[model samples]
Target chain A: MERCRELVRPALVEAVGRLHPWTGEMAAYALGWADTAGNPDPGGSEGKGVRQALTVLGAEAVGADGRDAVPGAVAVELVHTFSLLHDDIMDADTLRRQRPAVWKAYGTGPAVLAGDALLAQAVTVLAEAPNPRAAAAVRHLCRTLNALVSGQAQDLRFEHRPWNGPGAVGPEQYRSMAEHKTGALLGSAIALGAILGGAPDETVTALERAGRHLGLAFQAVDDILGIWGDPAVTGKPTHGDLRQRKKTYPILTALADSGRAAHELAALLDSPQRIDGEAAGRAAALVEEAGGRAATRDEARRHLDTAHRTLRDVPLTRTAAQELDTLFTHLLDRTW
Target chain B: MERCRELVRPALVEAVGRLHPWTGEMAAYALGWADTAGNPDPGGSEGKGVRQALTVLGAEAVGADGRDAVPGAVAVELVHTFSLLHDDIMDADTLRRQRPAVWKAYGTGPAVLAGDALLAQAVTVLAEAPNPRAAAAVRHLCRTLNALVSGQAQDLRFEHRPWNGPGAVGPEQYRSMAEHKTGALLGSAIALGAILGGAPDETVTALERAGRHLGLAFQAVDDILGIWGDPAVTGKPTHGDLRQRKKTYPILTALADSGRAAHELAALLDSPQRIDGEAAGRAAALVEEAGGRAATRDEARRHLDTAHRTLRDVPLTRTAAQELDTLFTHLLDRTW
Candidate 1:
């Protein structure tokens, strides 16, 4: 992961440097390289670079140098950051990476333009890459963007749906939304790496499938953390998703159960009163009583198993495969 | 132009149809195919399709059928629509095509997602096009997106600068912003059409230059209309830009002159009070007295002449060239 970050950092910086100076500063701030005041961050509070690691590992697994996938890594990271910037506004998320969100630091208008600049830079970087598969990479990125937008639309629409009645969000719907919202980009990262590394179509497809499964596992874990993780560890308040009435995996699973606890939780959620701290605590207990916690954990484990099986089935360089296994385990085995 | 619209309409509709139902509805609304209720608009308050016309004409001028550039035309129109939707949110403009802007009708978050969906679709449409130069076309579109974002950033930044100071926006800066915000896509529309039609690089470059000049001319005329045109004709309130304190061409030109009228106009604009109807009327007279009106007209004519000269020098199909000339004249000669 560190190696991947090193390979991607310079190119990502250069790509963002092409934006208008005002927006470029906002992009840098959003990426955690700079603070709101445009001062360089000595602590280097950048992202975990999981997508970058996936891209680099996918390339190495295909018997190519990790550096060969640097462009893909940078492109995926840019797209991820772009989505974060825009999503902060859409979701009204006040904080990101333990700091005020881009829209909060700058105004909504500037944040929107900054996000746009990053997205454009993502496409431009891919299109200008010297790799022979650059065109296919751009196509894959565009398709991923389409999926991301669709997922966001679904998530927003889910906000207005009934809590438990006719229009209630179901497990299948939640999975579909999560797959589009989270899986598409992860899948594209691996696929882009493999494609740019000259992997066969079958290999790329298999790797992408594995990446999708990993994404589902990741989202399941994130939903768990959203409700119960330590604030210091997660960089978010406990029950944040519940407060927002987000249709996350655990909540949807809890709602799917037919039980007294499920009905009580539904009634609580459907109430006109805001989900205050005490209500959120009670709701969290009710969710657990309805077997939401166990179900969510089981779902995460299942996806992780499937991802492992998929990875095992694919032919990859021996050392790189081991490294990928370690990375997956590190990412999904988080207590927070 | 009608022929170009005919070729592009179905493809454009189909491209937008690929978005999630909720955002697709908003995208349709933004494109003027639907109203606030998501019902189809019988009046079809669609844009003039000038970019689409330029694209098809560019193809024809390079000896290809207009139909050959449908993908390029559709891509440009989608990109243009995307910009309008986002720009309305950034500018807080409530109206588009005599209807509520997408953000006004669907909320800011939905509008942002809808704009994003259209942008993704634009790239996807170009990438999936059957044209041999589709890859080049995608690259051109991405570069144009970068320019558009930069232009928007510059425009937003201009709003914060002092009206008259070292950091004040100059005519050169305005021209650069206008070229990026308006000319980049227009130039790309023509360039993509030519490239997709397999025109030589030199011809594509020449055609793009002509398109840029036309874009500048178009923007100058729009600036004139923004300040002086009838609301019934322009589909906007009189002095709409002035009311917003927008650094438009006329206002900037008027402020640049060394004269009593210029100083008076500057003082009026510098005041904290909002420019109401009467003040806008007085400011209009001051602009004309300061030579801004004449200078702006002269600027438009100069760009138009340059565009015409570029077109005359280019080697093009005779009938197609004549058709393009007519299209340019018709577009630039608008009274509104």
Candidate 2:
């Protein structure tokens, strides 16, 4: 993953630089490539490059050198950053990667415009790619964007009401939202990589399925961490999702459990004038007592298992399959 | 122009519907095709369709049926509305087309997402345009988006300081900003239409130049109306730009005039408090007194004449050229 990210970093930087000079500067700052002054900033934390890794690995799985997948990798990364930048604004998050968010540091207007510019540049880079499948890649990316935006719109509308409010979301709806928000992009990353590398249709479809399951597993773990992980280890506040009343995996699962503990959890969340730490702690305990935590863990494992099964028969080389198997295992093995 | 707009309305509606069901609703509302309840709103005022007209006219000039240009037309109009949705949030404007802005009515989060979705749909529509130049058309649209975002970023930055503040803007800088903000899309509208309609390379280049000058002229006239138009007729408050302290074409030109009235206008704008209606009136008068109004009028006429001359030799049917000449004259004839 690190090798793939490092290989694409220069091209990604060059692609962003192709934006108008002012937008280029703001995007550089947002991407951790530079400070607000346009000078390089090495200390800023960066994303883990999971999507880019999927792209490269998918290409290699099709017996193509991963270098040809760099453009697809860069395109996915740009789209990822674009969503993050806009999401931070919509969620009113002040911190990202342990620093002030782009909206906080540069103001909301520039952050929004910079995100828009990055999205445009993403399509431009793909269309300019030296491949016959560039147009198809652009179409896939746009479809992914629509899904991501739809999921975000649903998430925001969900915020206006409590978990038990009218038209309440159930576990199924939550799973679908998860797929739209994260799985769509991850799936597209692999599909675009395979298409660009001239992989067969069945191979692309198989990789997309694997990537989606991997995304689901990854997000499920993230939801669990949001509620129960030690702040020291996870770098997130304990019971953060409970305090925010986010309809994450565990919360939705607990609500659907429809038992005494689920009732108590809902009551506690409904009483919120913003949940205090103690109440958040109690809420987390209630969710666990309702069997939500175990169920969520089972769901994550199920997705991971399905991901492995789907990749089992794909026509990848022996070494490529082994690498992909290792990759899925590593992704799903993040600390609970 | 109205005929062209009406002709493309159904296709535009269908194109937006291709977004996710949730986003399609919001985008439909933002585009004024539907109300907040997701039902058609016939009374809603439509866009002037200048960009779409350029596309159809460009196509007609190249001896193609205007139907072949509908996709490019829809693409440009989508991009235009996308900018409006995001810019309304950045500008904090409460009203658009006599209704509450999308951000004001549907909340900022959805407004931003809907705008992003529209932009993606724009590219997707072009990529699916069934033309050999689809990829090239997508590239042009993306490039235009980058320029538009860059111009908006500069516009927002211009808001942070007085006219004479460090990195102060002059008339030349203002012109570049105008070109990027409006000219880029308008120019691309014509260029894309021509390219997709199979116009010769030189004719495409000529139409692009003509479209750019037409955009500058349009903006210059809009600046004049922003200050001095009848409120009932323009549906805007008197001296709206002065109240906002916008460094519009007239203001920049007056500031560069370096006369006593110009100095007084600068001082009035530099006053720490917000400019009231009374002060706005004074500023408007000072701009006119400093020859800014006449200079701006001259500038608009110069661009219009250049546009006319540039299109003179382009190989178009006599009726098409005559139609275009009438359109340019009509655009520049807005009452002050």
Task: Report the number of the highest-DockQ candidate.
Answer: 1
i-RMSD values for every candidate model? 0.7, 1.5
lDDT tens digits, residue span B61-82, model 2: 8888888888999999999999
Residue-wise C-alpha lDDT for candidate 2, range A1-336, written one tens digit per residue? 788788888889899878878788878777877887778888676778888888888888898888878899999999999999999998988877766888898888778888998898888888889988888888778888888887787777677656785577878888888888988888888888888888988888998888888888888998999898878777678898898788888888888886899999888877747797898889999999998899899989998898899889788877767877888899877678
Model 2 bad stretches (over 4 Å): A37-39, B39-43
Alpha carbon deviation, residue A235, candidate 1 (Å): 2.2
Docking class of 1: high
Residue A319 error, candidate 2, Å = 3.4
TM match of model 1 to true structure = 0.98
lDDT of 1 by residue, B1-336 (tens): 777898889998899888899888988888888877889997549888999999999999999988889999999999999999999999888988888888888889888888899998999999989877999999889889999999998888888888887877888889999999998888888888898899999999999998898899999999999998889899888987787778988889899998999999989999999999999889989998998788889888999888888989989999988988898788898883
Q: Which pairs of residues clash in candidate 1, taking residues 3 or more apart in a chain or in different chains?
A: none
Backbone clashes, candidate 2: 0
A-chain TM-score per prediction?
Answer: 0.98, 0.96
Give candidate 1 regions above 4 Å deviation: none
What is the per-residue lDDT of model 1 for residues A70-130, given as tens digits with 9 covering 90 to 100? Answer: 8899999999999999999999999888888999989898888888888989988998899
Using TM-score, give the best candidate's number. 1
